[model samples]
Target: MPVLLLALIVFLSDQISKLLVRQWLQPNQSVPVLNNIFHLTYINNPGAAFGIFAYQTPLFIILTLAVIGIIIIAYKQFPIHNRLNLKLALALQLGGALGNLLDRIRFGYVVDFLDFRVWPVFNLADVAIVLGVGLIIWELWRKEEKGEAQ
Candidate 1:
């Protein structure tokens, strides 16, 4: 389906960007794209986003695998009608999860860059996952509103 294709695109792009970042930048190297406001700083995150739970590599890896499995089943179970947003959200989450999972398996950590001074440095996978979650939340809110109106 198109959502699956979208997932492929997100996954490939995330992996490719990580590959380039790892090759071009040394660990903890910062190249300012916007003079500290933004930069490409390479960091190998051994934990979840924002560096939380910084020592649970095995648990994170297992949880990621479970999320991937759940998404696959949810995607297939959903009927193809007017649920494009839901589908896309699931696809994105799947892709992002897989991207990070790949890094965790290969390097025992995830490659993160795209530094914004206000927040912790993150990468494309993080972005995709956040956007997907936002979309999912919006869909749920919409459904709740519809039910309320009914």
Candidate 2:
């Protein structure tokens, strides 16, 4: 249930924000929300993060599918007795990946809007992916400190 909720929230948030950005901002239009720090800049990414693999749609599609499969298999390995964080992290990744994957399939690109000057421009799906990774790392560190890693 928690996993499902996490996935749903991420999917809904990502899609809604992308839709809003598409409606309000034209391609290459940027509106600063914070002085030199944060902005909303419309961009369509035809490839993976940092714009890698541009024009490699087929390769990205295949890789996304493979990642989805791996996430599922990895999630299944999570201990049933563990905290909900692991499930939530996996769910977040599942939702974010699917969100971008859907765009790649439908538009041949991923809609990205959120922009931070210090970091790469990203969207809600990117947030989910980063947060999910952070949670997983935190869990690993916690387990290691407790000598409970197995």
Query: By TM-score, who's the top model here?
Result: 2
Per-residue lDDT of candidate 1, residues 1-150 (tens digit):
887798889999999999999999999999999996999999999989889998688999999999999888887785635777888899899889989999998988999998998999999988999999999889889989888431
Q: Candidate 1 clashing pairs?
A: none
- Runs of candidate 1 with Cα error greater than 4 angstroms are 148-150
- lDDT for model 1 comes to 0.89
Estimate candidate 2's alpha-carbon lDDT, on a 0 to 1 scale.
0.87
How many residue pairs clash (N, CA or C atoms closer than 3 angstroms) in each of the candidate models, in the order given? 0, 0
Q: Write the per-residue lDDT of candidate 2 for residues 9-69, one digit (tens) a residue.
A: 8988999999999999999899999979899999999878999888788888898899889
- Displacement of the residue 2 alpha carbon in candidate 2, Å: 2.0
Instruction: At residue 20, give the lDDT of candidate 1.
Output: 98
List where candidate 2 sits over 4 angstroms from the true fold.
none
